[model samples]
Target chain A: MEPWTTAPAGPSSAPEMPSPGGNPVGRVEEVLAQFFMDGKLRAAATDPAYLTLWEALEQAVAGGKRSRPQLVLAAYQHLARPAERAAENAVLLAASFELLHSAFVVHDDVIDRDTVRRGVPNVSGRYRQRALRDGADADTAAHAGDSAGLLAGDLALSGAYRLLRRVRTAPERRERLHDILDEAIFASIGGELLDVELSRSPVMPTPERMCRTARCKTSVYSFEAPLEAGAVLAGADSSVVAALTSSGRHAGIAYQVVDDVLGVFGHHSRTGKADWGDLREGKRTVLLAYAATRPEWQHIAHLIGSPHLTAAEAEHIRRVLTDCGARDHAISVAEDNARRALDFLEHDGVPSPLRAELTALLQGVMDRVRPE
Target chain B: MEPWTTAPAGPSSAPEMPSPGGNPVGRVEEVLAQFFMDGKLRAAATDPAYLTLWEALEQAVAGGKRSRPQLVLAAYQHLARPAERAAENAVLLAASFELLHSAFVVHDDVIDRDTVRRGVPNVSGRYRQRALRDGADADTAAHAGDSAGLLAGDLALSGAYRLLRRVRTAPERRERLHDILDEAIFASIGGELLDVELSRSPVMPTPERMCRTARCKTSVYSFEAPLEAGAVLAGADSSVVAALTSSGRHAGIAYQVVDDVLGVFGHHSRTGKADWGDLREGKRTVLLAYAATRPEWQHIAHLIGSPHLTAAEAEHIRRVLTDCGARDHAISVAEDNARRALDFLEHDGVPSPLRAELTALLQGVMDRVRPE
Candidate 1:
């Protein structure tokens, strides 16, 4: 009856783990949503402008399933009772993910000049549109929007600190909270700087280099830190914490590599990502690496670097990516990560119920990560 | 003796005490110097780029006389033992002043875009010059420098938080430290926003509005917060803290108004400011307020708004400022502040020894601040 192994091994538990609180996934999301709303409401009295940011934050938090936090809490549940009280800690961890995610997105939008995200106008774009609608001239509206977005992002970053300052953890747990947040932010910012720098001058643009950038820039925040923070906060043993980061590192890379694949081949409706998004940005994704390795690489590169490439030209580049088997390679890499993730689950000291759900979650991610 | 009133208040003591560690004025400068150097060194390890910022920070910090931190510490000393552990609390208070000042300079540099500051090339200016020397094209170099300056300022801000987080004050003291730092930064930011909006719109250019902006934006960070934080950290009584804030507020406004005068009328070599700096930038200072209120207001306003005003014409405007006695009026305001500051030193609850030193410091500042 241990939490780590309630579900059977591999890809067979999807039907058994029903919705609502019957399964850990449903329970984790439900708890996280309520917790996020409550935290936002508590601070509403301080400033009403923040309420607008809180709403945007809630939406941006939704695309990711509660994978990292669940991994942490499931691991914790294996060692102790999984009850409502413990869920409070889980909520904190989940909200940290959302806050951290919003910080990255805000900064990323600035980097990419991305006008939209999640099928709606992104933060910067929203402000720009609002300014124009408010009767400002075009250039003034654009400048105002950019300034508002920049300041709003600054506010969110501070808001993250404010949230962490209120954590009711034991003194020992609390001491490490600031360190965790600071390190993650610093690492992510460094990675972002490198990512932006490399776009202009792809220093040693090897597949391996691109993967390192992906893992550090995106994966660490998206996965490893959240999982590791949760384990540490729950008072898990160092050994268990080490396992969480290891599994998280592998899973995080896999998620990003698949994300790269989806960015190229997936439709706008399913992933809420623009078709050929990474291709247009000249993002040095692993798929792009495969394209680089081809004899026709120069031709594909030319189209990518072209500003006025027609739809036909864009489709041709897409076909070349598929023809080079870049899509297949990306999926294989994702599967490799899932297999490695399950390997970590099977380690001898893991509690069974936690192991079962982790294995199920890994399989679920792998299945969903594949293109429809 | 109460720390707030330990200094002698006789007129004979005023000329004797204001220079170095021999009197309260000297002690404040000594304390601030040590605090600024130690803080810069501690934060220098963050990155190689930060070392460049630290250099700029060190330079920007030294330019201001140790007025605010000194006032705070002297006020604290007047309420308690003049020399009793005052050094330790003074360093903390001095650190707050420098950090708060650092924040203002960074934000102000962003607004002004004048690269040289405090007799040295500013962070933004350095970046611009280096980029051009590195053979970046003209437009690229300018853009690079602007962005570098923005990021440099952002890093300095983060460093401020890092400094505050490590403060070892008692719980109640810790609570005020939070309030002081947060409220000062928030208020200054609000003021900067208002200034930016006004510069764009020119609709709400009332003298009262400009003075309010000056008080909220510069006064708190420049004078009040540093003094209040020092007194609070030293465990001084509330009344002492209140007196320090009110006195510091007036002094801050006076200092800025004097700065406005120098920006218009002073020589570049003496003031380390371009003679036409404020005129070139079109800053709306207290001088502008005076011009707006004069019987010859329309004539002056026409010249200020005109695009064709030559350097000679700008010098004529400066002559008119002197003729209207606006410069004298500003000096009188500074004298009024000095008197108010000395009166606070004479409060009955203040200790005699501290009060004597404070009275001397006030006189010294007035001497230096007086129009030449």
Candidate 2:
């Protein structure tokens, strides 16, 4: 049988993928930790002030899910023969995904002017706080903070390429590695650009349009590319690569759809997001687009993007969304996307054990957004 | 004769380097043009709004000196065998330098909050204008503009790596190609980080400290790395590469010194810089650092870094700097560095024809910065 289409082996035949050679995700963490350590050393050598950037970067990325790297490992292990899998190299390549994510989240904070991220002060927020402590005025402090964020994000972006380049892959595959990364970055930026514009546009985007943006902005890089990169690295056939990539695309959009729902509904403790932000900013997510289609939206439309959105007003908006079935509407869309993602694994391209693992991973991340 | 120690040859020995290939610099420009054009198409295909970013990038870099690419060509031709001179590949590499520059300048504008670049509105400025014209408030418009700049700069940064990766070169040298570019980017970012921090620091940095910052921020990638990359591509010995790299470092510092002088004294018409900005921002330039050392600085010290600095106050500050011998002090430092740069050619590693071309290139660029 073709390696891509092989049947799943029993539990014994399933190699220890994530924990192979003892917790591979731990290796990705180590790569990141070491990369930042060297960065700190270099910054200290250059000027002590630069250490602030490296420190902020290290701090911001410290508690990430490491999902991207895990995806790489899963795809690689599923496709590669035991002899072909170089666990260490796979870890390095996977680490690059987290680095790229750091770059995106950092810059996105700057664009959104968000001081807090993941229930903590983000890179810009940290810098801003430091500047304020130094007795600079609010404006100067804000400028300093965002500048640091911009510079730090640049480092992470370039640093991602550095980590990717370090993976000891075949010479023939190296250029493809870089090409996939570049393409993913390109699509992600486009998604970000479209997303912000949609919020600011006079005409509201439809749910479908928002979904397209989600696929471009979040799904392509976050899900599709990582899976594709892993398959490509494992030398999977092109058809298998495409199938895996398409599956990832659907899963990523599902992730985004659920993310939008959680942004307004999930508690800060549960999701690391301020429930007030998405509604206050008038972010045109699939959830909001669904709500826009309801007659009740007219009564609460002003509440959606109010700069001084109160907890009371937000609660009222949330209630309206739920009553109008907008909440369920958005949830069903996410379910459809997630189901579509799982369908790809059910077919010939993926192994059965791989199928079960991907299904679990998708459900785990999306559990909060899914119906209890 | 050993290639590194080859004696100066007559007219026949000198190959047609820059023009022999019929304006390779134009090819570099072509590569950049095509890259931006494709970016625009992709943006258009995704959403028309993204075209604004590609347009801003294309415009931001259109009138550049192309000095970096020329430096590459000179270094490569000076060392490569006639048959080894693949001009197209060399142009692609050189063009990456410019792409990186575009990223730096765009991000720097966001950091500096500069509205104008090269005597015109910059990337942020353009986006800000469009937003305002569309009826957005001042704050909203400014946010839109900077967001665009930030996103566009990210594209350019990634785009540089793409271009660098595209250069077809010897397999052994490939990793080195990426390594050199990464090292240069790392140093350049370090330089930018320090440059901002220096201007913001409460304690004034000395002229020596400022010069070191200049070396990291402007010189590393601009001059040193380009020459080193070119030499490495042409398969120059490590020693030759080191010499040329050192030569570029000194020359780059000279260029920065002159730029500081120009920032305060050179007209917008001449240098494409706002004469008032450096003084208004209390920018801790090498020139200002020298001025701070003179006793006369006590009389007008308060005017520096004054956010509301008047035109007359700026004129007074310029005169104080000049009369205090700070101007000559800076000019002398620039001259010393330039002389040091040229002295590298006086050694055995470089050939005479290459020496003459590099000399002309250095002087031509510095002519505006140097005294008549």
Candidate 3:
């Protein structure tokens, strides 16, 4: 059987299969699109100024893989057969995750001073370009872009809670959902702060610290929180919630590991980010930590964080990373995490069909990170 | 009767009346102190890094007159005879307001590039100092400070919601509180964004636009939302809520108008900010708008928004504003707003005792801005 036939559709699956029958991802996209339209109308009714804010928000949230929302909806579907109202609530919950993700993305771009995302000028970049076109000097234009981006992110953050408030659920369940979201947001901010600090610190961080950063920054929001939010909305039992939480934690770590690996090795066309961007930024990744243990690092350490690092230098770094076994180490860690996620699902008594689906989905993600 | 004897204790009242029988503001301070202690403990338990964040947030919140929280608690006390549980819930709601305010203050410093607040280094300033001490370049230090301040604000914003979630109120009432807060946050952010845009634009904003910005930025959160939150917690009727909202809106506008006036004319020792800071930043206040219509403005227009504006230049601009009648015009507008607020309270049938207290409180605040 084809991979997607046996598993839920994910990033690698049928791109043209819009609303492919049982696909929750397609439904999530539809919900997000409708939400954008409704938001536009609301903004228009309020003030013309808000209309620009809503437009920028819409753009910031657009054209992603919808992975976080997918996790929410899929987790909900796997746990319960919801009635119509419950199903709608699931979509709102899913949309809230997307909004939260957008908040992080917009702010992250500003902090990283990144102008492009997904191969296009991001929210800040678009604003910067507009200001420059309107005759602002470079410094003024940059400040305007950062201000616009900062406010857009704030709107998205607040909008996430607003969306959650509108989700029609029992007050108790809604309260629980708010708790999960609050914790995730707190953890994510902590992680982002730590990441900033580590990047600037003169001393290199320990591998343990790096791993903790990954968990705080990526896993909590990207996996554990969304999965838990879905389970709470579904009124899943404690055992099921715990199982999914564990499963998601491991899977999230795997996702980040794979992401770090792809940051250096994946083709620019495939990743839609500059292949050397992470290296240029001197990001502290698991691959980098592993490579630090190798003798090969000493020769090219000075070139690692140079903004003007040439393509040839990057190619040399990539070769050194592979030869020093750092690339293989990262892949193995991802595979290990993927297995651990499946193990939790199996032993923690997730229903058989759901377990099979999660396992297959995780396997598909892991497949992309495996060495050819 | 003396203002303190007739009205609630405010900033201008006795500082040593710690728990003078019915002092809501005193209780707010006590509650905020305890909350900070609890937050520090919680952060210590989580990670040492977060200790810095908690410390910065504590400083940002410290030294405020507790005016916003005072509004929340005082409004609640006047509207309803609360049981012990209801009283505790009121304090929680009040603290949430302070958290929201802190969020705005920290982010505002980043947006305005202001290094000092309340006569001391703000959260961003502290972080920037630390980065510089660590020997980072000026640009890197500034970026680091901004990133830290940005995340700290996000934490405080999220913490506001977290505190609200813990309030032990009826679910319906809690929902209403969330709605009020969400609207306030949305409005405040809109106002802040507009302020940034106006300051950056070469063209001057209209007086109407300036007023709208004040309403959206200051009045909504500072006055309207806190009052509404208190009333909702007290289960006040819709008419009462509407009356208070109107009263708060006018009071808030007057407060901002007074603040703008002080930004230019007040002594630095009294205002705890540079007297010329607003002029240097070229804030488009109603005072500025009114002055723009006068022929005298033509001579001093170039002096506005100059980063290196001297005390002499600022004094010259101040004289021009007075000579052109802009200062008088702004004071008149503020007085009008203050009167409207009192009028709303009287006509809206706020109980006699509460009406007296609110009137005296607003009058006390207005006295500071009234022309000598």
Candidate 4:
């Protein structure tokens, strides 16, 4: 059930493997199972074809690292420490993050036109294959697949918010939870729109703009929102929650910066994704943005974004990126953001164990680009 | 601001003309304008391209008949009459439906490969046009358009749910409000997926299945859910609410049936939609489903889904549908559902004026096909 049950994830599917990183991940899975079971029942209650959709979602959520939910738990523990697990409702809150992430991933696949996820056929890919098998021509089959994917993404996204209704908390806290959900979803969509706009733009996007897009895309949901919700559920002091969320924001940017770097330069076996895909797609990555400003960019500008580049051409492009120092500058940006994420450790409210955990996580993000 | 300001909507963009048949629509627009202004600010807070997405949404919502929101108000006034308005929160709830509908329209455009909405360039259309203007090829332009459409749709959909947060209500009733939202969105997405699957399906869909699809697609949100939410907000008795909802469900089925018929046989000037697009798209309409069971179907089955279907060929298909009695049968189904909707007039809880309104509404749905 962990993916690669078909075709592994491409560049955008982060945390390709779930990390058992001392978070209460198992309970989150329980919440997800219950949530998805209800959705599957309702979706398929009328038609069996819809059941296939929920089934794909089940596989999609099962494949992630569960890092976002872990942030929820970690933030909760900073306030409700020594309590092995957050309450059931809080776990549902955490589960909502994973559900929303799955929604974004499914939708992202449609946007990027990627047919695979987590080494398996994504929602779009599966539907496309089925349509093809059913004898439709290529174009119609693809269209059918994307349509199904769009609807599936809707189900998951709505289901994510619906999951929040089951969580019982104080009224004010509930408002905060809704607010967090709104912010995360809103910011992430804005980020996604920015990414799409930047990629197809005739003018090259600035590195600053790319970084802003990356931060917006991943920060609020993957880090700030979930963590803030967790703290709210724990009834943590407002100041503590704010500072912790700020830390999460920086970490989100760092995480994305590392992800963008990994999309191009990380070892395929290590990162669990194909390298140079970002380059070939003409991605609005900080690395590329930096390279475009450098003199060496002229030599390989034509080679990038070509659908049929040979391995030699890719190698040449990568060497140019490295020689031009764009790769190093991007790495340093990741390092700076990661360092900033750790700045919250000495704050009065952050617990010692939480501090240790944050250190480990930031180190992990940096290690992606650091490991020789 | 009704749809077709540009290409008009195709078969699926129902309620092309916002009927001003005595519903409280003015306030709904005010709410929509305020909601979108906030969204535009947040979306464009970082980038101008993002602002264009919100602007497209503004036009999309403005273009609809606002019938769904009208349903909410109509239902509310039935329960809480003698008052000029139901309440502000209820108005927010009504507006949420229109927002959600706009979200669906935007996404539906993408799924159907439609680039126009409300007679103007849709979110996708605008984005794709810009890309083309920026020198992208047709394929890239189309992809860029669809991608933006996807994100725009997500914003509106998520915004719809977020709008629910602003409506202050009692806890239990709030739960019911949430429930209605869930049911409406879930049922609608399921309906959409079914439509997509049926159209591409190798096996011809039965008339019964097509009827079910139309009912699911239009009933819950456009009629039943809004009606139920209105009753809930007014704190009407559970039985009364249920009866009202049952009527709404019937009316919705009738509405869709009339819509399908109008898509083919209704005069273009009357319906504000092209008459033969459904036939050209091989839509799994109940009329087509019924016709497929008859002898005359063979005369035009090949031309049913053909893209190059000529006006004369379309006329032949229309005559075949009518001559085979399929058209009559479809009309009767619409009438039956419309009549069932009127049956609620006699329900114990329905006030006199409300009953009169419901009757008129049902007759209106029937009139689309009857106008001749």
Tell me, by DockQ, which candidate is best: 4
DockQ of 1: 0.14
Instruction: Candidate 3: list runs displaced more than 4 Å.
Output: A1-21, A24-46, A81-85, B1-21, B24-46, B82-85
| Reference-based lDDT, residue A286, model 1 | 77
Local distance difference test values of all predictions, in order: 0.59, 0.80, 0.77, 0.79
Per-residue accuracy of model 2 over A176-275 as CA lDDT, tens digit each: 8788899899988888888878888866788888998998888887789988998888888888888889889998887787778877886765444566
Q: If both were scored by DockQ, which would come out higher, candidate 1 or candidate 3? A: 3
Model 1, residue B369: C-alpha shift (Å): 5.9
Report iRMS values in order. 4.6, 0.9, 1.4, 1.0
lDDT of 3 by residue, B27-123 (tens): 6677678867877786676567777888988888874556677778767887875453367788889888988888888888788776666657888
TM-score of chain A taken by itself, candidate 4: 0.92
Question: Can you rank all candidates by lDDT, best first?
Answer: 2, 4, 3, 1
lDDT of 4 by residue, B125-176 (tens): 9888988999999989999989888888898898889887788877998898
Steric overlap count per candidate: 39, 0, 0, 14
Candidate 1 per-residue lDDT, tens place, A1-372, comes to 001111232335343221112225555466546645764673354234344545555555564444445554555456543442465565555555555566566646644566566456766677678667867677656555444444444445554555565556776776675666665665555455445544544332667766776666766765667766766776767787677677777777776776677666656654556566566767667777766777767667776745566768778988887878777777887798767777776666567766666666565556655544
What order do you get sorting by TM-score, best first?
4, 2, 3, 1
The 10-residue segment of model 3 chain A with minimum total lDDT is A1-10
Please report, as a residue range, the 10-residue window in candidate 4 chain A with the lowest summed lDDT: A1-10
A-chain TM-score of every model: 0.80, 0.90, 0.90, 0.92
Give TM-scores of the second chain, every candidate: 0.79, 0.90, 0.91, 0.92
Clash pairs, model 2 backbone: none
